[model samples]
Target: MEKPLILVTNDDGITAPGIRALIKVMNKLGTVCVVAPDSPQSGMGHAITVNDTLYCDAVVVDKDAPQKEYRCSGTPVDCVKLAVNEILGRKPDLCVSGINHGSNSSINVLYSGTMSAAVEAGTQGIPSIGFSLLDYSLEADFEPVLEHVEILAKQCLEHGLPTGVVLNVNFPKVSKEGIKGIKVCRQADAHWVERFDKRVNPLGREYYWLSGDFVNNDKGEDTDEWALANDYISVVPVQFDMTAYQALNQLNNWNFSQ
Candidate 1:
């Protein structure tokens, strides 16, 4: 059997340690091709380059690595689009994004370029997964999560994800032994309490820096937030469909003819 072709990408740019570590694991599983942002695009969500020209160039970030890599000057979603539409000659068997520097759990998925890349691939009928670590540091250790990453990716390849669904996997910042297990769970009903730090620049211009505290009010033990808090890796299946099916019947009862 031919080795499965795997497409790997991330929002943290091509040379990020997170991605480099991911490539190492992927190379062991199958043929790997990386198409990622040329620079950090952390909270870009599913944005595409519409107003500006896009560029994707072949590059050798690690000459020793076997995978062919491209550095794209666009959002994370743009990388997947280019990979699928232009780069790869055939549809990839699997698409994996991130090993991101921070968490993409719960509501953060709405603002994450990492998860958005996976969501983009999922929309194209590819089995996709977005992996994130709870630590937000540039030098955060990803060793503990590598085993779980391999396991999940292998499982995805073995048993394809449901139509239009992608996986959002988040790992706690713990040692390999500290990890309890993996939990397939739902997104926690949580949100950020935000504030803007208004300040003046050296030229006396006003500026605002966005900041916030994460508040989890949902006490459900089956949520992604709860799983991470208890040292288990959380895997939430996300779908691209945004329709509210329950609201259809309720709105149909309204008197629109009057």
Candidate 2:
């Protein structure tokens, strides 16, 4: 039996503790190759560099680490594109993104660079997963979720995922024992209530800083938001297709003969 080839990436920069922790766990699984952003690209959603030049440089962030690593000067999605097209000689068995610094649950996935990378891999028929923790702190402890990460990755490699689907896994801020269990749930109907704080610099120019509160409107117990709130790790299977199948028939019934 041969060791599986795994590709690891994240929206957080290559040197971030979150990605470094992910790399440590992946090394135990198989041959690992990392191509992540050189700087944090938190909210870049599936963005690819078109007009600008992209750079991917092989670098050694940790001497003891076994994985071949590259720091990409582009979005998380761009990293995946480059890794698949240029870096890796063969297709990877699995692709894992994140172990991100903060949550990408509910509607946050729409803007998350973490999930976008996984989604990009999923688009290419790869078994992919995006992992996130609720903690926003740079020094947040990732030790608790590492075991679960390994378990999920192993399962993904063993069973494989459905076509056009990727897993979005979010961990609540809890101790290892504090976790109730894992829950496969649907994405919550939630969105940000945004507000901008207007301020002036010393040059007398006004600027606005974007800020928002996350609000969950859905009361469904089967939602990812509910699972996380109840101390469970939430796994939501997300698909790349944006079509609304239910609306197709309704649109067909409309009068267009004129």
Candidate 3:
């Protein structure tokens, strides 16, 4: 039996420690081909490069396993498209993104480049999972979640995911023992209220630096935010379709005749 072909990617650049850790884990599971951004593309949403020309270079990051890595001058979603269309030339058995430097739980999923990569793979009908550790440091340790990530990856390979769906997995930023078991949950209702700090430049010109507080309004215990807060890894099944199907009839009943 052939080893499963896995396409691994991330928003935190291909050379980041997070991606390196993910690549190491993925190599153990299958024939891993990494196609990630040349630089960090975090919080880029599902952006694509259209006007600019895209560049993909084969890199020999690992001396022993040459030709297994690629750096793309594109967004995370673009990396998936380029990997599927240009690099692999065939659909992979599984697609995994991130082991991200920070969490993508709750509303973060809407802005996460990591999740976008996984969603892009799911859109292509590939089983995909986006893993994130709730640590934001450049050198954040991923040793704790590695086993969990491997387990989830293997599970996805074994059971396979539903169509048009991808798993958003987030781990707590603690030791393996400090972390509780995984919990399948829904995305928490949350939003970041932007509060730009006004500042002055050296030339006395005004400027603004983006800042915000993460406001989690959902009090439900079954949400991803709640699970993470309780030291449990959260797994939320996410979809690309953002349609409010239930609101269709509600909109139809609204007074639009003027």
Candidate 4:
């Protein structure tokens, strides 16, 4: 049987440990092609490199497997677009982003380059999944989630996803044993309570650092937040369509035609 062609990418840049770990896992499953950002683009949400000139270079990052590697000077979404449109000779069977250094659960998914990359691929009708770890440390151990990645990625390959949907998979910052199991869940209704600390720089210039604490207001046990808190991997099926369908009839009854 032919191996699956997998497109691997990340927001944490090509050289980051996160993407490297992801590449290692993907290499086990199929023929892997990596086209990721040249530098970190973490908070960029589904952004493409339209305003600036984009550059993609074929590089020998891993001498053993030299040909399928590329580095791009664009957001994670651009990496996918470039790989599908310009780089790869064929469209990939699957697109996987991240093994992100930080979480993309709940509200963070909206701003995550990791999730955005998967969402971009989802929009292109490719089967996609985004993997994230709760640990934000540069040296965080990704070994724990690797097997889980294989499990989920293999499932996506075997079963395929529904139209317009991609998986948002997040792991807790726990040891492999601590991870009870993978839980399929809905996105938690949560938000960041933000505060900006205003300060003066060395040259007497004012600067502000954005900081916030994540607040989960939903008490639902089936939410992503609850799953993570309970030491389970959370898999939220996300879609690009942002329609508020429940409000359609309510607004129609408002008599806008009058």
Model 4: residues >4 Å from true position, as ranges?
A: 255-258
- Reference-based lDDT, each prediction: 0.96, 0.96, 0.94, 0.93
Q: Cα RMSD to native, each candidate?
A: 0.9, 1.0, 1.2, 1.3
> In model 1, what is the error at residue 216, expressed in angstroms?
0.9
Off by over 4 Å in 3: none
Tell me which of candidates 3 and 4 scores higher on lDDT.
3
Off by over 4 Å in 1: none
Q: Which residue pairs show backbone clashes in model 3?
A: none
Cα lDDT tens digits, model 1, 63-175, are 78899999999999999999999999888999999989999999999999999999999999999999999998889899999999999999999999999999999999999
Candidate 2 lDDT by residue in tens digits, 1-84: 999999999998898899999999999999999999999999999899999999999999899878999999999999999999
Residue 67 in candidate 1 has what lDDT? 98
- Model 2 scores a TM of 0.98
Residue-wise C-alpha lDDT for candidate 3, range 1-258, written one tens digit per residue: 899999999999988899889989888899989999999999999999999999999987778862388999999999999999999989999999998999999999999999999999999999999999999999899998899999999999999999889999999888889988999999999999999999999999999998999999899999999999999999999998889999999899989988
Q: Which run of 10 residues does model 2 get worst, by summed lDDT?
A: 82-91
Candidate 4 C-alpha lDDT tens digits along 70-100: 9999999999999999988778999999989
Assess the local accuracy of residue 118 in candidate 2 as a C-alpha lDDT between 0 and 100. Answer: 98
Error of 2 at 109 (Å): 1.1
Clash counts for all predictions = 0, 0, 0, 0
